[model samples]
Target: MRIQEFLQHHGIATNPFADEDAQTDLVFKTACIRSVYHPAWDKIYGDPSEPATAVVFGEKGSGKTAIRLQIARHLADHNADHPQQQVFVVPYDDLNPFLDRFRERFSARRRRRPDRVLSQWHLWDHIDAILALAVTQLVDRLLGVRDARHPAARDEPLDCTMLDGSQKRDVLLLAVCYDQSTADNRLKRWQQLRRKLGVSVWMSYWDIAVGVAVTAIVLAAIALLGGWNWLLTVWPYVAIAAGWLPCGWRLLKWTWKAWQIARCTRTLRQTIPFLRRMLMRFPAGQLEGQPLPVRAATDDRYAMLDKLQGVLRTLGFAGIVVLVDRVDEPYLVNGSTDLMRALIWPMLDNKLLKHPGLGVKLLLPSDLERLLDREDRDF
Candidate 1:
């Protein structure tokens, strides 16, 4: 007898256990996602009004991904109902891009060793990756850039009018630092977002204009006061070069700052020149005293996350929910339990998991649960 006939004899409509992965399993996607519920469902999925963090560990084929999909589906339903107090869902399962960039940061010899590469991973790197993903998605919504892969992209686009001037600046700043779309022109997309948000970029070009104006004035002074022959002299050129001192100094400062950010944010695939160029597009006054993710500590990242949450709140998001799943699937980890432990241990910090206005759901492998006993009370 065929499997379908055997399942029918048991009074079952279809086979639910036939598929292993929930992402590609048609049966689970159509039926089980709505009806099936784990015993710990209520505990894992707390009140949507005020999100909470939950960490779950299970062996392979234990429905961890299914639970993640269910949470996403339920959150979508909740968002449709409660439009004002919606939770911003950030699916943080994809780790290959981050791991690839992180490995490039090390030497060839060091990159060969998975332990060494993963050992360098810290909570700040994770935070940077999350911020990059979140900011990129928001930019897509604002610009109406559609990607078939992103389910939420088909939904209503974000209302740009809802954001005020400061919030607009915050969104633009976040995009400059973290938007990582390889398909579109980064500068053009940023300019489009700036226009959509009604942000003024005139101030960003003030320094360059000042340098050019000063150079023009110097050349005109030499021609009018000392005759055209003075323009051919070395003194005129010297004065013209001196006129660019302000622009040159600002460029140097921003370049150094970009290098620091690129070096410190090891997981993000950004170069010094690109980051510097993006930084130059922002007005100096707008970026003054801003918390940039250019340090090794988590303090700056937390502050940036707070800024993001505040912006989201103004845009109708009551809170943020980060769903982290598939810890062992990245190429570097390759299903190795030891490397998975190294990659995930840094994110177990209570402070980050319990951060206000944020909910982090880490779906991990069962193997890592054994190492939890060795951790101290602080973890």
Candidate 2:
């Protein structure tokens, strides 16, 4: 069927999972759906001043990610027009429970058919974490958020039957994505992300312990047979130990640093970007001309977002789309100003934003919208 006609049947709301872009606000994005911009959906949102930044704000079940996926798919099918446009940072790690979320959200949506999904639960709380980075992708190297090796990657949404077995549905992670505004409550819960982290930590520690234990066993056997001389002379056991110990130490250090990064990230993610004005000191430049220097901050949010945006942009090649799911959980729990300052405000009027051809869409919390409106009186 014709793309526009299909969109009409589905309604205008953006559907990251749908095949094409619908002209409406909740309209899906695809190459076939002509934008008022270019004949094709190629160039960066046409004029940045026009779209500025198109955010898909909502909680997890409000369908924000679904909308983003549809956009990505559209970009993939017609990337020829936007050879430079790409899906910079697909949250491949975040699709762990989409079907269940869809089911929950669909149920809630059936109840009221509200014009927007932000009223539901803290649907897009997770967006609070990733939106800034997504915004940075517009002019960065990772415009499309993929490696050069696979610039035109696209995954069609699972068949309806994928979620058909029971009253509620469940599905495995199929592809990377940017947001999760599909939940009924809109960017509300992020137990899935937290659960994923818990599983990752558990598995990583298990693997590390296993590796060390195996190495120790081998070393003990060497000692049993002879000593350091016998082991090192033949197996280089002493040298091996020397090399492995530092490697192991560094690995452990990095892992610990990563944990710290996660914790620090949750705490100061919002305020990081605003402090980026301090980038004057760092020796930073990208192979891609679209460059932003590293900045000094009492916090690492600025550095992290800058780096993530830069690297991912270069990888994306085409362009970048930021999908922020579950954006309200943090604000709902710990509403702080530094985060708002360091991260959110920086991107709101960021230099990266000044660059042409980028799209930063987020599914944020309704409470955040209210809070931000109150704080800045944007409302």
Candidate 3:
């Protein structure tokens, strides 16, 4: 029997078993994402009232990437339905940049096991990268909504009044390191930026107060020395420096630290162009260019993660789902079970996997299943 005749006799509309990539095949992709819903869909997507995280393990051709796309589509639908309680979706499927960064940063390692070194690359890096991705996407979406010049956003209808001007600026600045916007938009947000964002502060009141106190003390000393005439001539310069010196120094320190982060991490480094564009927005160059609130490598990850969750909450995002897939594609991993093991180990951190406001859907390759037994926690 001919193939078409056999297919017609079988009552099949088309070749369902074709040897094409499911992600690219139109019929297969639609079937996976829209037509058919998996049994575990609800569990993985989770309750909207409470954000949750889940891990899905499957081998090649097991529909892992398909599931990721399904979740993203579902969340987008949910957002479209309920704009007031929208969930931001951050798709972090790319791994090449991360792999490149790992290679560059740790060139001369002890060279024990590739997997071991991958594990030692630290969960903090993974967490930091995920947070950065979320912030970048959020900024891009907001800018696209406000400005029509950029690429059209996939955002559902969102209530702009969810965030105040200052809060909006805070979120905008967080993204400025990742995505570019017009100079006018950048300047607007820069001007609206607050001195403090929760525990984080752009410029501290104590620093300014100290400068004022020092200026007063110096002026008093000059008065006691009976050199009021000379003091008058120099007082203006002294006062100006003292008033602005502390603020400028703090900004310089933050800029230097931000530069370090950009240098050390490829994820952060990509944001440099956006940072420069933001800097140019300020004609006086007085705006602080410190975008991410990263401190040291270790502590900053957790701190920034918490801050990012808070920012998302303030932006009226009831949930933020980070979809991670494509584990074996990068040259660093290259389908090696060892490299995949090392890379995915840190991501299994319970704290990150089960964040309150953030939902993580980790679509892991089946090869990672063997390593799961080593650190078998409830997470």
Candidate 4:
């Protein structure tokens, strides 16, 4: 029988492979296909921001990414209103092809999303990436739909270009620890955030940006303001200073903020004598901060989560269905194996992301579920 007739004859879904399946390709099919139908996906994972997310954990080759992908496909096909609902959980290795198709959707006037690459240790590694994205978020807040489709052109890129990963993460940590309203003057506030939070790295980057601008101005001025010979020696020094300026500024900015927070924490400790005495039994850092280098495999695991989340908030606002997958056990074990809560807390948070009209489901290994001591709300 012919392939199309064969597929039509069987009630089962078409062959899944892109190349091998003879339906699309054997390896995988575009998620935008129309064969998807659902009965109860609407009941369980249908409502995002509802209450608690459905989380499942599993080991390698456990069909975790697959199940989540299937559910994601269903959500996308059924809910056409919001096109950017997503499926994350593939490794960074697979992201290139995923993004290729996603971009095509944009040209087609449909919403799109690439799979989230779960790199090892990235959950901890994402401070820089998150901050970079946050800066873009600020830009989005300011510019709105004029720049909505092109995330690459905004502050996310500039944010990364200016700060090293470690420095960026420290800044993000401070942002989370503190909150403020940016309803107006987002650019001004976002710019001032580094100073308000005391992020030295931000200062360094800021100065670098200024120095580059100033050097450009100085060179332009040299044509009229002074002799070119002075410009030669001064230019190199200016360039060198301009070069280190951003790094130093970032270092200074974060250092200053860290200092202020430290002072505030210290003052609070001193004045609350009885409370301090009661809290003395608590461990100092493993709870508040667990450095990633100590646990080599514990970085950047969910580096893509914040990106996924930003898209969800956007989709939810637009009245679309957003499906997130491969998020169960979305954390990694780190160096301090001695303590358990560090790893447990993020896992707990991942499990709690459910809200109305939005769904994040997991196809996880049963063994992993046992290891984490959690139950899948859907399963």
Candidate 5:
């Protein structure tokens, strides 16, 4: 009997043991692998009401990615059922962009201890990027639902009225700044925001140039007015003050607004220092301008992380879960133990791990398990 005739006899449509299985997505293929699928599901995706943070470690072909996908699917389904109280999943699995940025930062560390330099690279940029993406997605969806410009939006089952005008503007500004597709205009808008928030206390080049031109014109007018009256020399002194007037007026306006925001958001006994500084520096005042702050590259990463968490809590998300996997992929690691140690150590901070309204599912390679075991203290 031919091979086709033998399979037809057994009522099989195709070869059951074909290598084509390797080409499929692991999440679907692992559905039949009860031993691997069931345990992972029970630990990570079993109960929606019970909050959980877990670390799954396995070798390259051991179905780690499959579990991540399954957890996402489970959460998505849960979200679909309970739209009002949804659990947002922020996937921090893509490591390329962050790794590239991290490499740059690592190279720039000048003659410092490797561990100390690693500590400085405190994962704030990565955390900020994640939350920004989440906030953008949520705000955009809400706006699209309410916008009558789109015919399909009318059918979305969300109560757009839940967000007031100020909150809406705050969210919109965040979306614009976080959007990568936004061009040079993004940086310009960001600078405009810093001025409005009183964070950019210094005068920009454009402001200085405009003021200078105004002062020059004023000096010429005055000199011509007294053309042979011997007043041209004194006009230079007057023009000097006039040049600074435009810049001063703009600074005064910004200062007043910043003071208003700082006064309104101030409170007492804050746990998160980042939130404390942020609330003190730029509070949610008018919400007319961008709500996010632009930090220098050397600022504290922990503060950035805490500030982002506070922002999410303020936005009314009950829980935010960050899924992190593929630790071995970053070029910085390249199978080097020391490099991997530097990369993942800061993520183990006690405060970050124990933060409220946050859960991190870290799926690491089995090779890293050995490094994790060498820890001197309990985590």
Candidate 6:
């Protein structure tokens, strides 16, 4: 007797337990995801209007991922019903890319030691990774860059015109700093996004213009006053070099800032030169007073989150829900309880989990729950 026949005989359409992973479970994805309820459903999927943090630790195959999928499905439905007050979902489950980049930051010996590599993981790294994921997805949707891998891409493209000038600047600034998509040309996509947002980046090239103008003036002056022979003089060369001072200075500043950001954001796979180029694409005025993840502390990340929330609010996302799961699945962790503890312990901070307009659901392995007893009251 085949499984389908057996299930049909029992009044069931399909085998609910056929697939062990919630992500691939057809029964759960199609039917049970909407109707089924875990006993702790309300706690994990809290009030979307006023999002709150919830931490759940379940053993392997205990439906943690199922709950995550359920929350996503429910949020999709909620957003469809209440278009104005939607919750932006950031899926932080895929950690391999991040872990790979993080490992590259360490020495070979340290990289071999998964425990030591994970020990270097901090809350700020998590924040950076989450921001990168969210910003990248938002950019994809806003620019209509469809990728089948991204669930949000299946929906209609976002209306970029909804954002006013300030809001557009916020989104572009966020994308400039945090959009980490390997598939697309970063600068090209950014330009597309800028055009979509109707934000002018003409001012961003002022340094180059200044350099060109100064050089042209010096050459024209030399040609008229001193003739072609003057071009061979050191004075003309000096004048030409001086012409590039503004552009060189600007490049140096952006390089230093990019180095700082790359150093601080360990989980992101960004080359300093690449980051500098991206920063150079933004107007100085737009980037001024903006919060970038250039510090090891969480303050800047929180500020950036606030900026992201503001942009999302204008796009009708009233709040943000961050789903963190599959900690033990990362190659660095590889199901090591100690490594998982090291990786996830930093994110348990109250300040981050309970931030205003943000709800972080940390679906962790039950093995790490034992370490909670060792934690102090503040944790």
Which numbered prediction scores highest in lDDT against the true structure?
Answer: 1
User: Could you give candidate 6's per-residue lDDT for residues 1-379 as a string of tens digits?
Assistant: 9889999999996677888999998978877988989998998899988888999989999999998888888888888888888888899998999999989999998988888888888998899999999999889889777662553223777777888888888888788778998768887888888888887777889988888988899878877786888867799788778878878998999999999998998888777877898788788777788778888899999898899998888888879899888999988788988888888889988889879999998899888998887778877
Kindly indicate the candidate among 2 and 3 with the higher lDDT: 3
| Ranking of models by lDDT | 1, 6, 3, 5, 4, 2
Per-residue lDDT of candidate 5, residues 1-379 (tens digit)? 9888898999987656543323264436454433446454677664554445777888876767766766776676666676544566777776666555444444555424444444455445455556555644454444342432211112353343454444444443443334332223443434444443334323234557777887677768767786645353676666677778766765665555444432222111112332322222322244333333434331333443444444444444446777887777765555566766677776776666666667788878887789889778775
Model 1, 128-211: lDDT tens per residue? 999998888888888877661453223878898988888888898888788887768888888889888887777888778887
Q: Tell me the tens digit of each residue's lDDT in model 4 across 45-150.
A: 4442232355545465444454445554544443344333322211111122222322332333232211212211123322222323333443343334243432
What is the C-alpha local distance difference test score of each model? 0.86, 0.36, 0.62, 0.36, 0.53, 0.85
**Total colliding residue pairs, candidate 1:** 0
TM accuracy, model 4? 0.33
Cα lDDT tens digits, model 3, 249-326, are 766755665565566454444444445445433323334443454443545556556556666676666877778889
Could you tell me the C-alpha RMSD of candidate 6 in Å? 2.4
Cα distance off (Å), candidate 3, residue 76? 1.7
Clash count of each predicted structure: 0, 102, 0, 50, 0, 0
Output the better candidate (4/5) by lDDT: 5
| lDDT score of residue 150 within candidate 6 | 53
Ten contiguous residues minimizing lDDT sum, candidate 1: 145-154
Q: Any runs in candidate 5 off by more than 4 Å, and if so which?
A: 1-23, 26-36, 46-51, 105-120, 135-161, 164-231, 234-316, 335-338
Quick one: ranking by TM-score, best first?
1, 6, 3, 5, 2, 4
lDDT score, residue 173, model 1?
80
Cα lDDT of candidate 5 equals 0.53
Q: Write the per-residue lDDT of candidate 2 for residues 63-144, one digit (tens) a residue.
A: 4445455455455555545434444434322322432232243456452432232233221222323442243222122123
Off by over 4 Å in 1: 4-15, 148-154, 226-234
Best by TM-score: 1
Candidate 6 lowest-lDDT run of ten: 145-154
State the local distance difference test value for candidate 3: 0.62
List pairs with backbone clashes in candidate 3. Answer: none
